[model samples]
Target: MELYKAAMVLGGVGDALGYRNSRWERCPSGVAILSELKALGGLEGITVSADEWPVSDNTVMHIVTAETLVSDIWSLTDLYREMVKAYVEIVEQIHKRQPDPATIEGCSQLKPDNYLLGWHTPFNKKGSGFGAATKAMCVGMRYWQPEKLDNLVEVSIECGRMTHNHPTGFLGSLCTALFASYAVQRKPVVEWGREMLKVLNAAETYCRKTIRHMAEYQESWFYFETKWQSYLEERGIAQEGQNTPKFPKIYNAEERDQVYREWSSEGVGGRRGHDAPMIAYDALLSVDNNWTELCNHAMFHGGLGGATGSIAGCLYGLLFGMVDVPKGLYLNLEFREKLEELAAKLHKAANEGEAV
Candidate 1:
C-alpha cells in the first residue's frame, strides 16, 4: 500500500480503537451518541458497538486536513481558509446530531469565543489541546520539501490554529508533521528526534520573531516556550549537561502500564497536547520499529489513548507501510474504505502536483 493510505487508515484504526476503549468512561453520553450515529447509519456507514469501533474527532479532523490539501488550494492563505471551511462542515454535521452537553463542550473548545452564530468557529484561546496535533500527520506527509522545512512548520501551525491556537499545540503539530515527513523518507527514528529538535529550535526562533508583531500572542508564546523546554528536559531530549538519552527501549505490558502511571502521577497524562505526542514519542523510541508494540504502549496511556495511538500509528505507517499494522484492527473499523480512498487521493495529488 502507499504511504499515505497506510498512514490514514492506520491512524483512523488507532483512533477508533482508542476511542472505543478510553473515551466512554469520561464522556459516556458523547460515546453513546457517536455509537447511535453509527447504528443509525448517519456516519457514512461507520458503525460502533461492543464489537466494533468508530473513529472520533481525531480522525474526522485528519480527514478534513487531507481533504483540504487535496482540494487544490496551493497558497497558504487559501489552504487555511479551505481547512476552516472543511472543519466547520464536519463540526456542524455532528452538531446536527445533538451530541451530549459534555461532548459539545469538548467540541466547543475548538471554536473561537466570538464564533459566528450557528457556525462552529476555531478556538481563539491559546489552547494546548492534542486534537490539532493528532490530525497533523497528513499535512506533514502531503508536502515534502526539505528546503521548505520552515514553511512546512508555518503551514502546520496554521492547520493547528484552525482549532488549537496555542504554541504548545502548534509545537505538537509541528513535531508530528516533521516526524511524518522524515518517516516517509525512511529516515531512522533517531533521525526523526534529532530533526525534530533542530526544527523545534528554529521554530522557536520563528515564533519569537512572529510573536513580536502579534503582541496578543506574546503571553501564550512565552508560556509555550518555557513549558516546552521543561518538557524536553524531562524526556531527556534536552539537558543542561549530558548527551540526549537514546531512543527508549521497547516496554512490556507491565512497563507500559508503569509509564502511564508515572505520567498520570504528574497529573499530565492522556489528553494534554504535549503529553500525547510526548507519550507517542517515547513509545516510538522504545520500539525497534515494531508497529504493534508502539500502538500497544500508546494505547495503554488511558483516556487519550486514541490520540496517542493515532500519533504512533502514523509514524509506524510512514516507516513500515500498511502491511505491518495488525489486520485485526481493521476488521470492524468505521470508514475504512473512505479513509483508504482519501489517502489515495492525497498521495496522488502530492505526486502529480495537481488538485485532488
Candidate 2:
C-alpha cells in the first residue's frame, strides 16, 4: 500500500513541478490534451483548474498505465488497444482546442486517424524522446517482485512501443521501470545501478545480433548503442568488454554538486530519452535518500527537470515509502487527491492479487 501510494504521489508531484517549470513558452501535446480531458471530466472526475499546476503528458500517461494494470487488463495486446483508445480520445480533444504549434506537432505523430486500423499501423516517431521513461513508474510499481522482473521488462517495452516504438525510447523506458522495480523491492542503490548497466548491455547485444535479420530496428539500435557507449566513456566506466562497470556512489555534497554541474552542461534536462534516466540515477545516488534534495537537484537541470525529478522521486518513494517523504512536498501539489485515489486503487489491486 505504501509503495503504491508513494510511487503515484511522488511521481505526480515531480511531473507537476516539471510541467510548471517547462510551460513557459510551449505546452506539450499530452499536457494540452490532458488539460482538456480534465475540463471535460474525462479523467475520472479529476480536474485541474487554470490556476493549478498543470501536469505534463508524463503524469497523464502514468495515470492511464496505472489504471490499466490495476484493472487487471493484463494482455499486452489488450493493454495496447485500451491505451490507444485513451490516447485517441485525448488527441480528439486536443484537436478541438487551439493548441500551440509544438502540441500540434506532437499530436501529428500520434496518427489518431489510423489508430483504429491496428496498434502496429500508426506512424512510429523516430526521435528518442523521454515520454516512455516518464510514464514507466507504474510498470515498476505493479511488478516489483524479483520473480516478476522479466514480465516487468516485457510490459515496459510494450508500453513504450505504444508511443515510443524506437529501441532507444523503449530501452530507456525499460531502465526506468527496472530501476523503480528494484528500488521498490529494497535493492541497494549500488546494486541496481550495476544491474541497469547490465540490462543496457544485454539490450545492446541483442540489438547487434538481430540487426541483420531485423533491419527495421537498426537505426534506433545504433543510436542507443553509440550514445550509451559515449555516456559510459564520459563517466569513466567504459572499458573493453566491461559489461557492468561499478558505478561510483556519490557520498559527499561536493561530489554531488560536481555531477550536477557536469550533467547540466551536457544537456541532461533536454528531451532526449537517454539523458533523463542517467540524470535521475545520478541524483538518486548523490542524495542518499533525501527526496527533497534529489528533486531540487533534478529540477535544477531546467528543461528536463520534471522528468528527472519524477524518476528520482519515484525511486526515492519506492525506497523509503510514503512515511518518510517530507509532508511539505505534498502541500501545494494540485492533483494530490486524484493521485491518492489512483494509488489506493492500485494498492487494493495488488493486495487482492487481482484488480477489483
The residue ranges of model 1 lying beyond 4 angstroms of the native Cα positions read: 21-51, 94-126, 204-216, 220-268, 354-356
What does candidate 1 score on TM? 0.76
The clash numbers for all candidates, in the given order, read 7, 2
Q: On a 0 to 100 scale, what is the lDDT of residue 323 in model 2?
A: 47
Predicted candidate 1 versus true structure: per-residue lDDT over 1-356, tens digit per residue? 47777788878776775566444324423234344445745333444432556566677778778887878665765676676567656776545322222223434544332334222234445356677688788877776557657667877877665566566566778878888888777766654654576676677676566443245455555554455455556567664343345534655554554555455424435565666776777777777577656655665443476777778777777777766554656655666777788878767766677422
Give all candidate RMSDs, comma-separated: 7.0, 8.1
Whole-model lDDT per candidate: 0.62, 0.60
Best by TM-score: 1
Deviation (Å) of 191 in candidate 2: 2.4
Tens digits of per-residue lDDT, candidate 2, 1-356, equal: 66667777778666655455355213323334334434644323333332555556666667777777766475655666676666556655434222222223334455434534344423254536777787787777777777766567667876665666667677778888888878767876655645666666655454455332245566456665566566666555556445444445643434443554344324335355676677777666556777556654554434565666677767777777764454645655656777778878766655466421
